[model samples]
Target: MSAPDLLDYSRRWPLRLVLASVGLFLYLPLLVLVAMSFNDSRQTTVWRGFTLDWYARLGGNLELLAALGNSLAIAALATLLSLLLGTLAAIALWRFRFPGLGLVSAAFALPIVVPEICMGVAMLIFFARILPWPAGLPWPLSLGPIVIAHVAFIFPFVAVIVRARLESFNRETEEAARDLGAGPWRALLDVVVPHLKPSLVAGALLAFTLSLDDFVITFFTAGPDTVTFPVKVYSMVRFGVTPEVNAVSTVLLVLTVALTALALRVQALAGEKLAP
Candidate 1:
């Protein structure tokens, strides 16, 4: 409507440019990896020709298949555990304000703020030292330890996400249910849970993604038999890069992107309904 207004709009072009640059910076490597995965050459940079040999090779690779299965198992378990614990913790914190409430919340969030390496190493030490070594640890390691570490790190994310959802939630609904003779458990199940379901799902997805992609903690805690995909990828990367790695990464990328989109769609729908 005005020259100054037009100028302000024109200046916003820089923000778009910056966002484009950032996106390219983040995704360009993934593009290269995806492209290279089709290369027939041993050299990553020099692509001789395109072929699906890598994917075919990956199909028959038992070790890779096993690692993928293990990763899925761990991620699923960690996500479920984190969602349950984090949702309960968030509810307790939100519904009741008591002594050390803030402290408890902070403790839950500590894993997110602390450095990953520090957390991973500390967890490894705790499991190996603070806890007694069994007469013999099965597999020389157990998925249990890895799952515990993942839950510790991932629960904070779930709690933070779910707490945000709870912040804007109306407690009056729960109170109304309680006034109607519904007990606390019934009120939660019938009233609070419906409102919180979207956030809980989002939190679970986040936990699953974090656990699936985790390397540092898994590296430290996973024993010889408990190799997850990220750890397997790391091991493969140590020797050299392979097209199979790219294929695996691409599969993971697709799964994560699909899940993220689904979660966002659910959140959008939930928000629309929840809005006044």
Candidate 2:
């Protein structure tokens, strides 16, 4: 509208252009993948007429469905186990000081910092060669050792999240509960749990997402009999890419995003409760 304003706008155009370029570079491929999932033609490079056949066909693919089922089952189990162990670990580290407590706390977090490949290999060895289980142990449960490995890694995330949330919580309520003749466990269950519930939920969703998306660790530890969705997708791509792959992947992507958003929302609610 004016000479000075126009000059300033022109000066800012380079930065805006750079940002737009970066955004497209990051997301353009994902936009293409989502679009192609509806393509009638199997060829990825060529755009064909739109159809929902790919999504419909996913229901009929038994092998892919089985892999998806395995992924969900492992993720669910991992979320529960991690929440239990990690919550206790967080509360313990927060409520008490003891000899080697720093070391112990660091030990809880070590898995997060370690390379995933290293963790996966270590889990594979620990399950197959080390930890002695019953001779009658079933395959995958005791063989693939996926859920165990998932818990080992994901629990650290839970511990860290819960511990951070604990910092904002005042312990006065727990003390009041104890003052009212409640036992230690009673106070924990009645008082502490309610306050910590939101963080726990956020941690559970995050753990589930991590377990669902994990590939390197699952790939290293899974037995021949246990194929999770991601590993199955990898195998499928090696053979050939199909519209079904795109459809399944789009579904996974949407699920992951939804879970992550819900986790963040729960976390925000927890934070709002802490605000004055």
Candidate 3:
């Protein structure tokens, strides 16, 4: 427990090796998948030569293109909706002291902590069984249901992120805006909204990625005609993995990495703003 007895974990070779092994264990398959996307052979395991033919085919695949469109649309709409609803939720909880504040606040965390399968099933029942579908129709389940379901799960994440930003906020700024003859709405827009921008951007991107990558809930909510990229990819994988799928996945991998990096950059900027 003394200063000399304190272990230097960074210099520990055993710990460093384990960490390296864990990183490889997690990311090695992704590296292999990226390699396979350019494989010339039909066989997934055998690579005859590197070729970009699969990417060409991916561009021409109508079903996949449609699915990609659907995914992007759903993700964008869900992100916007979640940003609005979650920001409002965070603001309410941040600024108010309700009778059941603890209970209401805990409710926001449920979507994050609850199992996805359970949430999916709950969504299925809510959309299918609970809602009164027309007598003959299949309730016209499409991007609509999926967007709603995604917003339900995704907004809580936005709320948590925004609330964290709000916790660091200086109330004096808003008070100063009010003292300068600004109304409530003016104070929020001029003072608070500017402060929330980094969190908002970060939350929006996080929600977009979560909605884009989601499968379980999307699977439950999708109609016969509705197909998002993840669902399309899953159906293809059920038959067999192909180079085209690999190519699309590689593109998605790159996009995910880019978005993640952007989020981190925003977070770093936010940290700089918070620093003394």
Candidate 4:
């Protein structure tokens, strides 16, 4: 190899080492957690033997089951709501040039930029003070309130992803569809929707995962009866971390990995269709 090629290869090795080190730093703890989940002992310090006791324990734990159900319901609803609103907003923003468009977009994204803890506290106060049911009327402030807060935070992420996808869309194809006697709505539903599918799927997955894993925001907004998985995990950790908690973490990590792989496959298919 030439001297310059040798020099470039030498520079690349350190960068690769740095990248690998970063990945290891981020993932080693998760690996330990997963390994400890199978440890026979309750203590996290030493591994006595490998067993599935923690997984079995998870199945019999009613509290954890209830909390897991609550978290799933909340995440599903929040993901749906965020996807609907965010997709509509992204489409509107991309297809039109309205006054204060940039400002409106930024406003929509404020939830993502703000600290989640702050957003949670602020939303809690808003629900308590600014919005209240009238006397002799019903008020929804438990799970509903928590779901709304999660949707608020999750929508920004969905919008950002969908907007990026929409920006790269081939407008000429849409225009041609319109010219070929397709109405605007039909063009959007048939052509644009298909093109935006990958982003929408990715965004929904991201929103669902974030909503499911969030503890701080859920802690502030969730009522006593509406405990989520992360909140349950936090409560358990407060007393003491246990192998069962590790089991739950391992399950979540596995689920996250699976979802990410599915998203990647969807995106790859989308890219193939987009390639000229």
Stretches of candidate 1 exceeding 4 Å from the true structure: 1-20, 132-141
Q: Specify the poorest-scoring 10-residue window by lDDT in model 2.
A: 135-144
Candidate rank order under TM-score: 3, 1, 2, 4
lDDT of 4 by residue, 1-276 (tens): 888877775368788899889999999999988889888887656879889988999999999999998899898899999999899989998888989999998899898889978988887788778964233323233468888889888998998999998987999999999999999999999999998888888898888889988988888887667789988998999998778999988998998899888888887887798785
RMSD of each: 2.8, 3.8, 3.3, 3.2
What residue pairs clash in candidate 4, if any at all?
A: none
Evaluated with lDDT, which candidate comes out highest? 3
lDDT by residue (72-169, candidate 1, tens digit) is 88888899999998988888998897999879877887889899999888988987889744535554245788888899889879988888989978
Clashing residue pairs in candidate 1 (N, C-alpha, C atoms within 3 angstroms): none
**For candidate 1, what is the total of clashing residue pairs?**
0
- Model 3: how far residue 252 lies from native, Å: 0.9
lDDT of 4: 0.86
Model 2 lDDT per residue over 130-220, tens place: 9744444564364337898899999999999999889978789889988999999999999888888878988888898899889999998
TM-score of each: 0.88, 0.88, 0.89, 0.87
Cα lDDT of model 3 by residue, 153-243, tens digit: 9999999999999998999999998999999999998999889998899899889889998999899887667789999999999998778
Error of 4 at 38 (Å): 1.5
